[model samples]
Target: MNDNIKSFLSVLALVAVGASATLWWHDMMELRWESRRTMSEAARKDRMLAATRLLQQNGRVVNSVGSLGELIVPKVGGGTMILSGASGTALPGQAEEMLDWVRRGNTLIAEPRSLTSAEKAALAALDPSSEENDDEIEDEEEEVEEPKPAAAPASAQGKDEDKPKDDEDEEEDEEEDHTPPEPPARSYFTAVASDNKDPLTDRFGARVRRDAKACECRTEPAEEDKDKPEAIAAARRERDKTVSRLILPGKSYPLELDGGKMELVGLPNAVAPLWSDDDGGAVRVYREGKGQVVLVTNDYFSNYMLDERDHAQLLLALTELTPGRHVTIVRNLNVLPWYKALWRNYSLFLISLAGGVALMFWAAVRRFGPIIPAPKAERRSLLEHIDASGAWLWKADGGRQVLLEAAREDTLALIRRRAPALFRLPETQLWATLARDCSLPKADVSEALQQDAASHVTRFTRQIRTLQELRNHYER
Candidate 1:
């Protein structure tokens, strides 16, 4: 084959291999990321197999009744409306709806990459209760009977005398009432892919960090005498103690979508990604009721918290907040349609793939086409062409002898014609007249009479240039 054909075939073979490999690579990556590369139909059936289990575990299909029933209400277990690859603000007004659920003692298990302001506010508004240590010593357990205060100080035999001075007695009774601190308002039990110090951490434990700021608990206990009978009744003020719990799933949350873009436009200065000992930041909101926005840079209520290590703690938090009514929402890939997935789940891969295709196409079109031959330009030998070197000027007119003799006769005839009566003149006279007329410099007229072969060729070229130059001069 010609070189062009050979190269084109080689490139075509390469491209075919590349295209096949590209499709294969795409399928492989899709399998890895989207969880659909296997026998997809079978997997779908498997996820759906649990439908009956869902109905049995959670109450019933509430959605069949027109309302998504309660996404926020956590049951001993609950059914979920699982969604996948939700991009941008996936569930609009979901935050406000979630807040309403929180108020109704329901739970919202959101799996959005980045939580919205309204969503966060909904969570905060619910104020899910923190999980309390069920094993804590309660009033019944820590009673410490102590034999009814040892029958009251025996020196108190006279009841009339032992009575406290009017106002003092009344104040002592007031101070003696022992009441446990009021339980905190109900809050939310969120699942995030990331965790830092601040509201997201265990607020009762060690000092958690929030974006370089440390949040340590500082409790101010109620002031009450410990010694008196009424003193036991005296309540200690709840401590503002540092409560810290490292949210598992240590991955940074997608503040916006699966790519980690944040949803809320403005993040408060108080809340940061993580906290260190030096951090003094707090999480707060201060907008003029722009739909009650809540901004959380971290993902605390995402699917990443479902790891076995974290499941219990997350479940406990859920129970603490809403007790019997907590719902867990997860993003399930099987439920999504195939065509719509690339943009939502594999956007980066798709973009890079498009670029790769364009590059390969350009490389093929430019490097693998036929070779076209260049035009064969007419060539000329510079010196010979310029001088008409090899041409025979003598033969071009007539052969040597004929041309010479004809020139001699033409010149004689011309002389006779010009001289009028010279036709009858002697040979000697004719010859002399021809010589005289040759004195004129017109090469055309003079060349017609030349007889030498070599001289004719030389004179013909020279004669042509000279006569043409004269004619050009006359014309100009």
Candidate 2:
């Protein structure tokens, strides 16, 4: 190909590469935007964060805690506290303690199930008329009771005597008998406007209205109703139809509220109803000592519901009831994992423990000095074998005699090799000649050459030494 053709091909290749890079950059930007949107949605899972922020924005010092134990009670001029996400039941002995805290001039706002037996007792103490009414009913019942004998005589003629004597009495009896039986008690309650004045509800001139019977209030279906599809459909319809609204004098705003199903019953006369419904009170406030307790059955201040209607306004109103600037919100009673709690509370201790463990492990596995090369193998000397053999023979039975005989033979062989003329001589002459040649005593030479075994250790050792000396002198 010519230079022009090559240049044209190179330009086309560069253009293709640039177009591909542009497309890839656009796709990457799209993916980054999509991922950020997903993360933003996931970050909003906390249902109370919005409420906390609202309180902070309104100049209130807000603190969030998981349980009541973490609550910090103010020393003087007590603060307001909102307790949520807990069943109304108090742990053993917690009710009395909590009530005592409330009596110290703190305002407590919580659900119905959060109320303890001690609090109920305090409410009952506030209303003595209920007990009086019960007593009067008992007295009337006792007065209507008659003797058994008198009642039996009346029953004998009751068939005809039971008839009313006058039309007015008959109409009265019919009215009494035909009165519709009181509706069965329900487990749930709704929110409605109360006739009584309240500082919390008076600001907005509005109240949250909810359905009397909605599926959201019932956590589970009844055993008999579970099998009925019609019952299920009706409950779903009611749930769908349930539309809560903040109703003012002329205008109203749509609201969505999540509330507990527990009914607030046995309220004292001293409790000022902020909002109520046909079944029971939805919100109430009462005084104990210098403190006030505000009961809220519905959780309308949640993150999802805070911006709806006037829910946030109601929260601000509740906060205004207290003089203190601090507001503590107990969102849940969940216990944190041990590790997370340790890290949160005793971070220094956990860090120190981790550092100590790491140091210990390092110390255990650390090398102290340079590596030493392995020693080279060496052959044993002849003297070492002889010493080892002597040790083994010394430990054996009759080994001393055998050693003496071996030494005598070895001495004679040395003499014969060095001086064969001395061996040809008679025994006594040979010994004298060997002694003269060796420069050792004649008696030592004869004893060394003798075949007799030494009895004691001292004698045996001496004979072996003499034999070794004669052999050494002749070898030299």
State TM-scores per candidate: 0.21, 0.37
The 0-to-1 C-alpha lDDT of every candidate, in the order given, reads: 0.37, 0.60
User: Tens digit of lDDT per residue, candidate 2, span 1-476?
Assistant: 99999999999999999999999999775555233323245326555677788899989998777665454343323577777654343443444555666677777776544233343345448766534543454354354463354445656567546665686578778998988864432222211112122333232222222223432344446889876998788766555444343332223543333333333454333344444333343455666557666665577676656776567876776787668888878776534567765676798988899999999989977666788799999999999999998888877887767788888888788878887887678988988887786688887767767757666678777778888888888788
Winner by lDDT: 2
CA lDDT of 176 in candidate 1? Answer: 73
What's the CA error at residue 99 for candidate 2, in Å? 4.8
Clashes within 3 Å, all models in order = 51, 2
122-233, model 1: which lDDT tens digit per residue? 4434543211211121222244332354555556646636675895677667867763544432212112213211221121111111211111112223465455555444
* 405: Cα error in model 2, Å: 4.0
TM-score of predicted structure 1: 0.21
